[model samples]
Target: MNKDNLAARRAALIEQCAEQRVGLAFELNALRPSKVMAGLPLAGYVAANRKLALGAAGAALGLVLMRRKRLAGVATSALSAWKMARGALGILAQLRR
Candidate 1:
């Protein structure tokens, strides 16, 4: 937990790398501590937001499906009415002839 000791330890690590015939490059900045020593960051807000988004999407999809079913029924009824009207007109024309 002491910052001074931690800095000293890091310096010693870099020095040890040189002794082991390793090149000292900017890549050292990418070195991270082991997971056992470095605890993971909890993703609380991200998970909650993800669940909210998923629920919203599911509800939207359900609403769309219901609307589609209602539209299909309306379309079918309209087609039936047109067919009935055509049939009645044809019968009237035959009666006149």
Candidate 2:
């Protein structure tokens, strides 16, 4: 191609690249940590009440440490119940088929 045609093609490519860069920057801005966290409901609540959330978390940790044995027994009972229910469901499904 001639010099003018090449120059015109180069200018078009440059404009296209600039447009892509701007679009990419906008997309990256949307994916930023602060923007992403702001969109989450829990994150917004925690951000609004940082002290309250921290206090609740600390209390939960303290309870878990103090009642570890009781928690373990409850967890074991729950697991047993879940397994029994799952087995019953499987048997019912097989009977239906």
Candidate 3:
């Protein structure tokens, strides 16, 4: 009968739509992390609150200038340590490969 055919077609369409909805949900979950990172408010808030941002930057600059000698020594030590660690890591990675 015509009505039976129409009912079957409607059910098939509904099933197809449900399948598509599940696929869309999975894709959205996969994209959620990148979406959250892209939507972080820090940069936007800093742009909108320029005075606060500048004040923070100025404070940091003042601190660094006041401790220039000590900071430079620490920085040099840290850079050397980092290079050593990176070289060790590179050797480990090459061994693994």
Pick the lDDT winner.
Answer: 2
> Considering TM-score, which of the candidate structures 2 and 3 is the better prediction for this target?
2
TM-score of each: 0.32, 0.47, 0.38
CA lDDT for candidate 2: 0.91
**Candidate 1 per-residue lDDT over residues 3-24, each given as its tens digit:** 9999999999988988665443
Off by over 4 Å in 3: 34-97
**Candidate 2, clashing residue pairs?**
none
Could you tell me which 10 consecutive residues in candidate 2 have the lowest summed lDDT? 59-68
lDDT of 1: 0.72
Residue 50 Cα positional deviation in candidate 3, in Å, after optimal superposition: 18
How many clashes (backbone atoms < 3 Å, residues ≥3 apart in a chain or on different chains) does model 1 have? 0
User: In candidate 2, which residue ranges exceed 4 Å CA deviation?
Assistant: 39-59, 68-97
Question: What's the lDDT for all of these models?
Answer: 0.72, 0.91, 0.85
Best by TM-score: 2
Better of 2 and 3 by lDDT: 2
Could you give candidate 3's per-residue lDDT for residues 1-97 as a string of tens digits?
6999999999999999999999999899877755555566886677668899999999789667767788888779979999999999999999999
With candidate 1 superimposed using the best TM-score fit, by how many Å does residue 91's alpha carbon deviate from the native? 0.2
